[model samples]
Target chain A: MRVLITSGGTTERIDDVRGISNFATGSLGKITAEQFLQAGHEVFLLASETAILPEAAENLTIIHITTTDSLVKNMEKLVPEVDAVVHTMAVSDYQPVFMTALSNFSDDFSKDDLLHFSAEKVRKISSNSDFQLMLLKKTPKVISYIKKWNPQVQLFGFKLLAGVSEQELVDVAQKSLVKNQADFIIANDLENITKTQHEALLISFDRIVKMHTKLEIAQSILEKAQEAYHG
Target chain B: MRVLITSGGTTERIDDVRGISNFATGSLGKITAEQFLQAGHEVFLLASETAILPEAAENLTIIHITTTDSLVKNMEKLVPEVDAVVHTMAVSDYQPVFMTALSNFSDDFSKDDLLHFSAEKVRKISSNSDFQLMLLKKTPKVISYIKKWNPQVQLFGFKLLAGVSEQELVDVAQKSLVKNQADFIIANDLENITKTQHEALLISFDRIVKMHTKLEIAQSILEKAQEAYHG
Candidate 1:
């Protein structure tokens, strides 16, 4: 089977010099990609430019992505060719419309005076700037577009929630799985994640498999995806 | 001589999971620190947690910091003890006050509705958000405060500017150097920097040294600081 695995976090440009990015390191995705390659599967690793990567191999193709725009383009290009997608990339929720420097955070500030001229890209707002406002527009749902792009491709979605109950995380994961028409959902608790531990619940439509470590999770995911592809 | 070095890019939190950061990799700083260490200097490296770091050594003390607040705190504590400071860290200019979900980016919005409650770290906004406006107040000038922290400490500052003339870059760096009371400022062009090349001008009050590579830049900076310390 061919797999397109995404890892790490997407960054939305605030300007040529600055950006907003999430905190996904793509370590697990790198590990998962390795497991697939060991099983002799063709792997297209769609990863953040800053993500941890599996070593280059004959069966492994790496596509480094940055913003949500780049991610959309790459996923659209690869989703049709691959048999499955393990999307671990934490894609940004918003894209910048414009950024304006503010004088203060005072309540008396006028909305008409808000935009303050968004730059082309240079954002030469001087190193001497004080206060600012950034207007971010919601990006399209990147995951939902996967099934729409390739309905037959199996999808394994990962959801990270912090300070939430076990049941709540799973329920949210379940809903997301159904909504996205995914074959599996990995419900991850942010609180439980550390350098050593990455406890997660692998939920299918009918079953839940518990994973305690990143290695365990990677092996299980690789196996489950293989089972579905061959079954 | 004892030298304090700041490296990488500081992150300003938008929420618990999301943040705004700059593009510095801390690669140059790491290279510079190694040069200093090879020259038998005691190095105090205050770095962004995400930065590329020098390997641990008995003479090297590493302090990993995240936000602008942490950077300020660390600089204040370490400045008085060190003989010189090489500040290469890309600190954030603004910090988030609060974020509100916008139905749309229409100008019909009200400033009265501008500040949605600043969450206590856990930003539990639904994943189904449409739009958001983040108000960011300017952080205090970190470099200016450094000299105030320790009046006698020789300072080597790094300034990055994109899409600007060489003269403009130097002029700004010169102003920053004078304003911050830095002994030397490395004026860097964003366009000239790549994996192999790192064109920079090391500017002091009366002299400028041109450097064309990261290693060359590192060597020059180390020598200049050593000269100042010995003189």
Candidate 2:
């Protein structure tokens, strides 16, 4: 299977020293890539700059990209060839609305009175004809773009929720399946487990399966992939 | 304040090669210990056998011990002086109905000839009328045991669940709080966000707050500890 996975958070540079980054370690993305490779699937990872080292797998290809705009560019180039895509990266919802010339950029936040920057970097990236920017514009849903290119490719999307109950999670997951036009949705309780380690649950259409370890969860994903491929 | 925190899973030997262990990394407990120390509260950690190193903090007093019985012994010796206790360890719910000594044990597994071995190592350690191994016995809740010893000392307990919905979790948390007599409960959703770096929900008395980073969660826990101590 030709599988493409995205890991880590894309950095939307605010300045030379600082940028917007979602606090993510890319653990899930790395594990998914490892498992997919082990199962003899061709895997390509769209990774972001982070502390985690990508696992060295014989059949896996890693691409390091910094911004969501670049990620989308790479995805447009790769999505047509892949049979399945796992959208796991926590892409920043917005970048600075404008970009400064690299030569004139300042590392210190105090010296920001020079350039009168309009919020174009923020508005232009979010100004898709279909989506709107209310308080915060939604980053273009990568899955929708992928579907536009290759409608038959299997796509899995994730939903993380807090302060909501389990029934709501399943409801949200089901709703996301339709809203996002995804083949399957993994509804994660962002509040329960952390990257450290713990048991996990996989909620799918037929049933919910319990996985005790990270490896176990990855293996389950592999098995599900097999079912998807063979079915 | 002097605080005693127990964490990780206690492994009970099933035989020479196999055993039972709850999948706990002691991450939550260690983080709690780290939080306590950061808030100027003195902490003593009774950790289980895991390769991960305990984080160093100036206010922490690290104590390593194995087995539930040993942990109980340590608690008996130290609980008198501590200001609060957090029972976060995934202590074994059952010891081998009989513990076998290595010198007298034999490992021969033949499905046709099932043999049950009775050994002296399984003898009851303490004489308490309440400590009967009634068939299908539920593990004694640790917080209640600590409460019996020190009614004035604040105690927190942890509960882990898989595939439980959010509304169910709240009800379960409240019931556990009353049943365990815990001043507060750290209820974790084991199935969701198992390997993800960010995403977690903090369920308190009146609100379920969403936390997206380890640092934020750790800080929130520390703040809670400070509130508990100062109030």
* Predicted structure with the largest DockQ when compared to the true one: 1
Model 2 chain A TM-score equals 0.77
Candidate with top TM-score is: 1
Q: In each prediction, how many residue pairs overlap at the backbone (N, C-alpha, C within less than 3 A)?
A: 0, 10
Q: Candidate 1, residues B36-86: lDDT per residue as tens digits?
A: 999999999988767899999989999998899999998889999999899
Write down the TM-score of model 1's second chain. 0.92
DockQ of candidate 1 relative to the true structure = 0.51
* lDDT, each prediction: 0.85, 0.61
Q: Number of the top candidate by lDDT? A: 1
Q: Give a tens-digit lDDT track for model 1, residues A16-125.
A: 77798987888998999999999999999988877899998999999889899999999999999989999888988888877775544444544454545444455544
Q: What is the TM-score of each candidate against the true structure?
A: 0.91, 0.43
| Over 4 Å off, model 1 | A103-120, B55-58, B103-121
DockQ of 2: 0.01
Q: Model 1 — interface RMS deviation?
A: 3.9
